[model samples]
Target: MLIRYSKILLTAALGALILLVAINNVTDYATNYQFVSHVMSMDQVPTGSPLEWRAVTSVTLHRLFYAFIIAVEFSAAALVLAGAWRLLLRRKAEAARFNAAKDVAIAGLALAVGLYLFGFMAVGGEWFQMWRSLPDAEQAAFRFIGCAALVMLFLGQRDD
Candidate 1:
């Protein structure tokens, strides 16, 4: 088990390194991916600047970025289910099953919120209207998911 965890950690480190490298390459190659025509929105743009950064022409790239975000969110949520399955199969600590399940469920909830964020960005609905007009309350309510999951996990882990 220790070796498995070590490998997972190493893989995660390598993934992070790869991402860093990729982002650096993207930054270096920023000019090759643009073909601007007009300013997108002057209302929200800052003025008195040497370089104009309010325009966009990378529609293909934008869609890919959006799709990638959604894919990542879904993948993260699915990982929770995957973790639970892995735990059930390999974890011999019957006393910890509930806690483990709860942890996985919390992970799932986090992923669901990621999905929701993508939805909100894509839909562009009024952030505080047409759905009860309780943005703060909804945010607090969403936070409860992880809190409840954590409580369940801790309670299950307790000796009672």
Candidate 2:
């Protein structure tokens, strides 16, 4: 029972977090959009480096990338919310049956991992040199990724 509730709580919390992120991305669009713009354009990177060639200077691409990120965040939120509800409904079922219902939550976690770890840390931080920006967000990126990983680990445990 405890394990079942734990899994449900973890997923619910993750869902709430992702939903808030999506809301922020939508309501505060210009702020993060600027962050994306600068990162993609590599304007914050040190001048006179050969890596400057890798910058994507186009505003259109920046908006497109930011939109993609928001979409992923929104999708993850919806999946995890529905997954949490599913877990709640199946909490009293057999362990194997309840565990089998975790697929949606797992998919949500995967999307979050992809966004914070692969998308921000790998692509934006390393590829676009976002870490070198004057106001670097790599720390926050790592933190978000770590949170998702911790929740995923908890969710992966056997309910039995």
Query: Which candidate ranks first by TM-score, i.e. highest?
Result: 2
**TM-scores of the candidates in the order shown:** 0.35, 0.96
Expressed as tens digits, the lDDT of each residue in 1-160 for candidate 2 is 8878988998899899999999999999999999899889998777998899999989888899999999999999998888899899999999898999888998998898889998999899989999886335998888888888889889988777
Tens digit per residue, CA lDDT, model 1, 26-99: 56434322211111122223355433343333676444544554455445445544554554454444535434
The lDDT of each candidate is 0.39, 0.90
Q: What RMSD value applies to candidate 1? A: 12.9
Q: In each prediction, how many residue pairs overlap at the backbone (N, C-alpha, C within less than 3 A)?
A: 0, 0
Q: Considering summed lDDT, which 10 consecutive residues are worst modelled in model 2? A: 131-140
**Candidate 2 ranges beyond 4 A from true positions:** 134-136
